[model samples]
Structure formats: C-alpha cells, structure tokens
Target: MRRVLAALAAGAFLVTASACGSSGDSTGSDKASSSGGTTKVKVGVIPIVDVAPLYLGQEKGFFKKQGLELEVSLAQGGAAIVPAVASGQYQFGFSNSTSLMIAQSNNVPVKVVSNGIASTGVQGKDFGALTVKGDSSIKSADQVEGKKVAINTLKNINETAVRESVRKAGGDPDKVKFVELAFDQMPAALDSGQIDAAMVVEPALATVKSQGAREIASPLVDVAPDLTVAMYFTSTSYEQRNAAVVKRFQAAVAESLAYADAHPDEARQIVTTYTKIPAAVLAKVTLPAWPAEPDRASLDALQKLGQDDGLFKTAPDLDKLLP
Candidate 1:
C-alpha cells in the first residue's frame, strides 16, 4: 500500500506558492434562492491540481447557478477533513477516499457526494510517481525495505499506496521507516541522502525526476484501478437537510468537471489563483479526469483496503455514507 497524505496538523494551511489573489465574492445575494433556498457550504481543499474541477466551479460561477454559496477553506489534508465535514464545520469538501473510508468505518456520518479525479491510464496525467535519488542504490520497491522513506504524512494516501506497492514488490512494508516531510523538503532530503525515497505528486514529482531521482513506481489509476484519488463530500446530516442543495451542487460540480476536461489550459490557469505552482509547472503536470458520478468500486476498494490494512478498527456501512 502507498502512503496516504491525509493527516491534519497545526500548520496545515501552508501558503500556496502561486496564489494570485482571493477569488472575488461569488454570492448571488440579490437573486432569489433556488428550490431549497440559500445554502452555504464551506468546502475544504488542498491547493493542488487534483481538485481542479472545484476551482473551476468557483471561478466559473457553477456554485452560484446551484444557489450555493461556496466558501473554499484551506484544509490541512484529507485526514482531518473528515472531522471538519462530519461535525458540520465544513458543509462540503474535497478529500481522498481512504480517509473517508476509515471515517465512515468509525461512524463519522459522511458520504462521497461526487467523484473528482479518476485514473485514465495517463502517466503524470492521472497519477503520481515515486522517486529515489538517482545515484542511490535503491531502484525498486523491494529495495525500500529497512530504509527510511519520506511521505507527506503517515496513514494518508501516499503511505497507503507505497506500502501496497512495496508488498507487491516483495518487500515487507513494516520494515521500512517512515518520516513525514513537506513536498518542498523532499528534494533537499534526497540531496542530503536523509531519506531513501519520497512518494511525490506533480509538479514536485517532475521536479524530483529532473533532479535525477530514479523512478521507482507510478501510483494512480494503474496502481489502484478502482481507487478514487480525488472526491467531493459532505456530511450525512447536511445532505439530509439540504438534499436539493446537494444535488444542485453536484450538478454544478459535474459541469465544472466537464468544462475542465474541455479546457485544460483554463483549468490550469484557475488553479493558479490558489496554488503556488507557476504556469510552466502546470504545463508539464498531467491532470486527472473529473468523473460525473462517484466510483462505487473505488469506494469499496478503499473500504476493504482500510480494513485489511488496519487503517481503521471498524468498517462503517459505506452504503449509508453515499449521497
């Protein structure tokens, strides 16, 4: 399983490298509310390409059409986002399926309302890669055993996938030492030989590769075919009380996803508002697909993987969590 980057910490909302400016106010206060009335959803998201559809929704006014007032919040990561949504701190948010699976198992009362990014068999397009220092002796997952590895966080998406990949390569994942490091620190760590390898996503993945880190594996749709790398979510209570709102929100998001698919350059440009990556970085990084519907199989995979991997002690009724 690969390491999952879904944990939260105090300094979680690190400033995006390329945040151009705050998204101007998107509220349609003067217009009459839709069927369910004015609904405000504080959506938690990381400043990355995975959730590009969401940024498009905000930029293109899809939320407004749905009569939704979306306040996109900076989240630590997917791990902490479950609590934020489950407790109603965030009306909706984006997250990896792994944390949601474990949270559902723990009775967090959440559901994957919509799908975000699915693998399309495109390298650097729908998935990320793992890299080790080029000069280092480590070359494959099997060699990672008993070595120190750096991941964005423990028990998150990156960690989960790395463990699975390592095991698949005949390495005992438990034998590897894990360290939590930010994306920016990975190159330095590798340069200093402080960590044996790091599981990175673009543009960091590309950056490391350019620096001469040998490719170990690529985990995206290929690694976990049924796994949903990106997802949109809300609490069960919120969905129940605002069923119509949720549906409208879903429709808006679906539109945003379609638009992003058609206009990749514009999609990349919008992300510049929230991320630090330059246009050059976005150009090289591959963007994943924004599926119209949730991947039940992916959710199921995450649930089974979480339970089998002991990511959570109890498995929640995933059926109840789906909106």
Candidate 2:
C-alpha cells in the first residue's frame, strides 16, 4: 500500500479510497484497435500488489504474444477507472467487486473479464489483515467493539470484510467506527492511536508488522474466505465489439499469472517499476493470491456482502459479468 494507490474517494457511508500515480481522465487515445493490426487499449489499475500479474504480463511480453499493446494507467481505486473505461478511454480496468457491481447497478458499461486477486487466509499468504499495535488492548475481534479502525476505503472490500470479521469474532460491527486512510498512512495512524486498528493489504501490512504490529484478525480469510479481492475488467461495449481481442487479452493475463506464480522474486522485482516502494521494502512486502483466471463463485460471495450493505439494489448480472 505504500507504493500502491488508493485512488478514488467515495463519499459518506460508502466512502473508500486507495493511491493514484495520476488521475485516469479522458485525455488519451482510446483507439480500441488498430487498422495496422495490434489491439491497443489503455488499462486502468490500482497500484496494489493485486494487479501485479498485469504488469508481469507486460514485462513478459504476454500481451505482445496476443497481438495486444496494453497501456497501464494507475488510479487510486476502481471508482476512478470506471468512468475512464465507461467513456472508452480505458478498454480494460482493475477494480474490487463491490465497486464494479455498484457501478453496473447504476448501468455502467464495464464487465469483468478475469478475477484479479483472492484471499489466502494464512499468515504469509494472507494479503490483508486487521492489525493493531503490539501492546494494544484489542486482542480479539470482539474487542474491536467501540474501537476506531482504519481502512483503505470506507465501504469497499476491506471495510466490509473487517466488519464481517468483527461480527464473526463476536463483536457488534455497527459499534465500530471506520475511518478512511491510505494504506501506507495506516501504520502511523495506528502507532499514534489515531486509529485503534487498521484493515490493511500487503506490503503496507507487511511493513506495519515489521514495526511490531500484531494481527487482530485476517479479515479477508476470516470473514470472506477466498473472496475475490479485485478483478480485470473492461467496458461491456468493448467486449461486445471486440470479443476476440478481449479473449486474447484474458489469455495473456492468465499466462502472466502463471509467470508470477512460478517466478515470484522476478515478478516482485518487476513491481518496483510500477510502485514507488523502496527496493528493500518491496522485497519484504506480502503479496496476495493472484489467480490465473477469474472466479465467479468468489466474486458472488463478495457481491453478496456488498449487496447486503445496500451496495446494489439488484443482484449483479453475474452472467453478463463473466468474461
């Protein structure tokens, strides 16, 4: 999260955010395809480790093999990129399921083409966590009642999972106060007692633990096991127009996932190019479960949580969301 962007900031109860290298606005060429033959498209993403496979694909020439040229743009979170993709400036995008489903319920034109990340739910493999200071009194989820918790975004995946974990831990989630903060800022906030706990994702979470933070819970695993964290998506209209091109792109990313899984060190090294993380810190950062393909079931699990929170007025059009 230090180098990752929590790009978009939603308002009020549904508020959540992440980092951004720069905003992804409609100021670039959208040329969905080229008459010269290669499929050219802009891809929007958050700087989190979840989207490492896409970068791996780029580095390993997976996209090139598919006759595709991908332009990777970093945003704070899914909210910023949804408009970009909907407007055709971004042919593909990466975002959390809740954000995507909410967008679709509002009739956004995007459709998920692949599952991006999943929760490992273990000490090392876990990508996100509910962390508290080493000496903090909050030792269990039940203790989180009436406590202040920091999240990358207010109502997004992390917060939703944290609240669920709290309930599972025998605490009343409605009694907990959720505050929005960049993942990187969370450690300091926790240390300073500005927040009683933090729901954080890797590299940032890893950094905090290194500074002697203790895990109160692994929200991703405890509340939503193997829950779909984020995804690779594109405008629905783009897929309808260039189905073949979309398939090729998905294949390339799938290959990248394999590459990342097989060569983690090399893959983590490549992350440096996109994230501003220091070399030493990058080496120690916790990476998430980057899946080779999208998982519909896990996505639905996440969607259920979001829908229960009133994120969607209708069930997500799952059939249409699949790649």
Candidate 3:
C-alpha cells in the first residue's frame, strides 16, 4: 500500500495539524500576540515522515505557545507550494531545498524559515537510499553505471544525491539513466526489472527494504550527511511584515525538534497519528534528524549540486533563504 505521505503528496486534501483554539502559554508571552490575539498561518505540507516535527509541534502546543495556528494545507508537491506562498495564499510552506532554490532562481522570493528533516548519516539509518533487488548482482554505486535508475522525480534531490553517490563510488554519473516512478511503484519496478535500481525515501525505503530489497548506497548521506531534506518557508514580504511572528514560529519549531530528538518513542507515535503508517512498519522506520536550524554546509552543497547539474543558471544566494 502507498504511504499516506505519498497519497497526500499527490493532491489528497488539507488537514489542520493544530486543534481548536486553545489558551495561550500563560507563563510566557505570545510573540504573535502583536497580530492581535492569535495568528492563523496556513502552510502547504506533504504528509511525509520528514514533516513529523510540524505535527509534533501542534501536539506539544509549541505553536500555540507562540499564539500561531499552523494549518497544514496539503499540496501535491513543492511545485504547487511555491506559487501558493508566492501568491500570498499561504503564509508558509514545507518544500525540499532544491524546489525552493528553483523558485528563488526564478525570483519567487520564498525564504526558508527553519530546518526540517536531516539525514541520519549512519548507513541503514537514513530515510533515503539507492537500493536494488535482493538477488541483483549490483553491489555498489559503481555497478549502477550504465544502468537505469528510478527516482521519484528527475532533476531533484533524489537524482542529485544519487549522482553524487555515483561520482563518489568512482563511477561516471553521466553513464546512468534516470526514470521517474512513484515511490510505492518503485519496488515492484525493481522486482520486475523495469528499473535496475531506485533512489527512494522513507516509508517507501522501509517498504522496499522489507520486501527484500538491499541498499547499496545512502546517497543523501554519502553526498552530505545530516542533509536537510526540506524546510518551512514563506515569502520575503511575509517575513518582513511578521518578523516577530516568524521568530516565534521558528522558536516553536526548534523546540519541537529538540523535543522529538529527546522523545523518540512519542515522536514515532505522533508520526503514526498523522501519517497512519502501519504499526509494524512504523516501529521499523528510520526517523530523520531534526536540527534546530538548517545546516549551512549542507545547503551550500545542495545548491552547488544543482548548479553542477545545470538545474540553476547560477548558484542561489543561500543566506537569503535562511531565517
């Protein structure tokens, strides 16, 4: 079965991460109080594992403490999110670094406000990987050269990370062919020999691995470990108009990240609650690192990867995107 995150990423529908209005944090001042009582911040989000912190933040009352209502407006992909934030339809959004970079390259003015998920760095612990059928002869990234590789999307994080891994493995990145396939379909494609290998993310990675697929490389980690997969962002105008509100939101998110790292079991439960992943599978899923802030070095490497891949005409100003 397809993961809820994947389903949501394909235009499912909106579900508010926050509950009904609640009392403010009495001990602490609500920074968003300046917005007149409470602020409703709608964000375009995908229900993937990477976004667990957002849901956890809601459950922990982090956003409520800031007097902000974080409404999770589900969009199919980051392709849909950029325009929504740019048009002022949403106050914030969650998108991969590459997509946001592409938007900024087009001068969309969306700035990343905080970090989302980061790679685990340890092999077999990260959420993304290059995998082959369990019986395949492919033993390393080097073997993937001249082979057909499947990725959820082309010219995005998956391809970029896989390309980096191929290069690191002393293989010609150009020799590989890439085809797009939905995450859930990739395992079958691998099993049926439709694709030689696949660059997959979590829940799907968990899915494929459980189906006897073997991971030969962790591209996201190999290229840049603890890589920030996605982030919360908003238009530059919105950031300027709500500087205090933005700071408060970031603070709440940072708290949530720390909370998640400190409470792995509860974090897993929160993820299950929002995503509805199978209990058995959820227990085995590899959770991502939630850094309080975006890793600058990783972002730089990601931007450079895009530039090298010719996805961007010029390297984006990384500093401009950070909060």
TM-score of each: 0.83, 0.87, 0.83
Model 2 residue 229 CA deviation (Å) reads: 1.4
lDDT of 3 by residue, 267-320 (tens): 878867655468787777788888787887888888888899888755677777
Query: Largest lDDT belongs to which candidate?
Result: 3
Quote the positional error of residue 246 for candidate 2 in Å.
1.4
Q: Where is the poorest 10-residue window by lDDT in model 2? A: 1-10
Q: RMSD (Cα, Å) of candidate 2? A: 5.0
Candidate number of the best TM-score: 2
Sort the candidates on lDDT, descending order.
Answer: 3, 2, 1
lDDT string for model 1 (1-323, tens) is: 01122233223323211221342332412121334565666677765677777888878888888788776766436765665566555677787777677666656667788877776655434446667999989888878898888887577677777887787778888898888876657877887899989887655665676677877876554345645676888877777787787888889888989999889888767767876666666676666666676677766765666566778767767677665
Candidates 1 and 2 compared: the better one by TM-score is 2
Off by over 4 Å in 3: 1-36
Give Cα-based local distance difference scores for all models: 0.69, 0.74, 0.76
Better of 1 and 2 by lDDT: 2
